[model samples]
Target: MTTGPRGFRRALNRGIPRRNRTLVALVAFTVVLTAAILVWPTVAPLTGLVVPLLLGSILLSPRQLPWFVVFLMVMLMLAIGRQQTIEVRTVIAIAILYLLCFIVLVTSFRRTRLGVAGVLGESMLVDLRDRIQQQGGIPPLPPVWLVETALRSAGGTPFAGDFVVATRPRHSNRLEIALVDVSGKGEQAGTRALLLSGAFGGLLGALPPEDFLPAANDYLLRQAWAEGFATAVHLSLDIGTGEFEVRTAGHPPAAQLTAGAGRWTVHEA
Candidate 1:
């Protein structure tokens, strides 16, 4: 009913995606072994070495896979070229060579280090999401999280006007966050989003709701050039204060949810 780390690792190994190159090499080795066994009965046992080499490659990197293939080819050539007479010295020499080449090839593939950068990037992304949750923000659910989750993107990447921040501390207060989608979608528009996010992040942290809009706009004007303009919404909610405020400019209005009613309205500042 319970599993330890080893069991969990085994499960993970079983669950590993079979579509990766490792699985590809394994399948290729199996097919090649079966063919060799059927075609050359006398050398059928030697075909077993192919599987181990392929397995090593799976535990290695794409860059080292070619060397593994080369090692196997060399061994196969040596075995095939020799006469039927079995000599102890020849067998020992071939084994030593194979072992040396395998060691060198494993060292070269470096599965342990090859994908490290990608692994680190993924870990950092998770850490960012956890930090956002700690800062009273909610992350977007899956599928969206995989591609273009505003919440995830906002947390992981630098401040961008991609998502809103909201939090409700049960013992204290409640907050409603609204995100503004800019008029365009590109690097230029994205730069403006960054500017807006910086301005909003600063103003929302300290300024009152009334001062937030003007302060954000002033900051944006100072940062963005003549060709750069942004439309945004600033939303604040105070359940204890029994008040809500939204200031916006040509953007989607926030939806207010109540026990029995739903309403849509826009607030322009």
Candidate 2:
């Protein structure tokens, strides 16, 4: 009952519409076959070879292959009835060759699709990383270098529910940071995270340090999703004095490390 790669693949296949070039080619091939039947009655048997040839040129799903095979059989029978001395071996050889060609076509199409998807996926990741950087992910504070920092998604996916946005206001001596967790996970939560990141990034340095969290709360309240809720911690720190204030909403307490003691202490702000 679990959805693994195969299940996800099936879901994706169902969701995406594949181009039906084979159907169109089949129509054209049918027209040619009909014309041969009407105009050159003696050549009608040879014209049936074009059906399998046309089918082999395109990729086909398992469900469509049976119907195409039936069509080819019917065409072959009609061709046999119109002509004498039609070699059964020749027909079989042609069918085998067409099957091989169909397999090759399907393999090539799969490889091409996978290659294109990989390229596009990597490009999108690069763009998303650049956007996160532009929004000021893990701000650089002078004389207060971060000891360690890490961000991870729920299940090692590209999209995540948690996000951090940090900034130093213009002409101000304080650093503002917000760690937010959206209601869901994976792509859906990542979408909301991106939206909130944009909104919070804009609100962070623009508003007073004390007003930032309140503004964010108001923004979340105005959103249309009734069931959606988020947890966040907003921190404001003085670069010169090292004085800091932390605010939280439905989030865990902030922790501080005492370098000399080599221990961590939790702060409920």
Candidate 3:
């Protein structure tokens, strides 16, 4: 029988799909912003609104972005048309805005695939990287044992072809470690690294020490990616006995430093 302003707002919000709401709001704000810029075209800095709108568009659906761009293009054209004589700075500003729009639009398309928003896509990549790092971490070991791991990408970037996954399985005194180098370097191999990191991490302590590589090989074969291959080293070490088995797959041999002899011994792969 009665509805408050808040209730009306809630009802209105419920009508629009959750994904498109940001796009719609940004487009509406653009219209108002365009109006203000037009009203005081000479007084106001026209390019002031460009960055915010473009940044906001990253969170919007790619399909929704083209439409938003269309609205933006129309607003920009109308603003220029309304002016009796456009300044050189105005034309330069407009050109810069167009270039930014093109860059942002291209980025949105490349980053957001299969209907995923750019923000979500980026967050997912971050989450995957975090998981890889977490999996790479060596859990707290007893004081007697020391296990070390280090990873460096081909370049100075978060994404890389190299990663490691180590785990101490329940009901076992053995530590399982898998060192993987996916094909390519940096972003080119980052996707494959993310994928194999999880899979190799899962397979690390799951199977018997000797079965790990064959299983990993099987998993890689299933994907059937052309020129897609990875090099990995699996090491399962028994803390009690100080005995270990290092399995290699298209990877370099393991090296060990003999403390007493003060020499490095290379274990054949």
Q: How displaced is residue 147 in candidate 3, in Å? A: 2.1
Q: Write the per-residue lDDT of candidate 3 for residues 28-89, one digit (tens) a residue.
A: 78888788878987765667668555656666777777667767777888777766667788
1-269 per-residue lDDT for model 1 (tens digits): 54999898777668775435564565466557645744663666553655556465545455545555575655566444543544687577557656755674655556445443233445655665454334435433223222121443433444333545443433445454546554444443555664455456555646666776677668767865767666666666665565777777656555554535665444445
RMSD of each: 12.9, 14.6, 2.6
Candidate 2 RMSD to the real structure: 14.6
Write down the lDDT of every candidate, Cα atoms only: 0.54, 0.70, 0.82
TM-score of each: 0.39, 0.55, 0.86
**Model 3 ranges off by over 4 Å:** 1-12, 15-17, 106-114
**For candidate 1, which ten residues in a row score worst on lDDT?**
140-149
Off by over 4 Å in 2: 1-126, 133-136, 144-147
Measured by lDDT, the strongest candidate is 3
Candidate 1 error regions (>4 Å):
1-161, 167-176, 186-199, 225-227, 255-258, 261-269
Top-TM-score structure, candidate number: 3
Q: Give me the overall lDDT of model 2.
A: 0.70
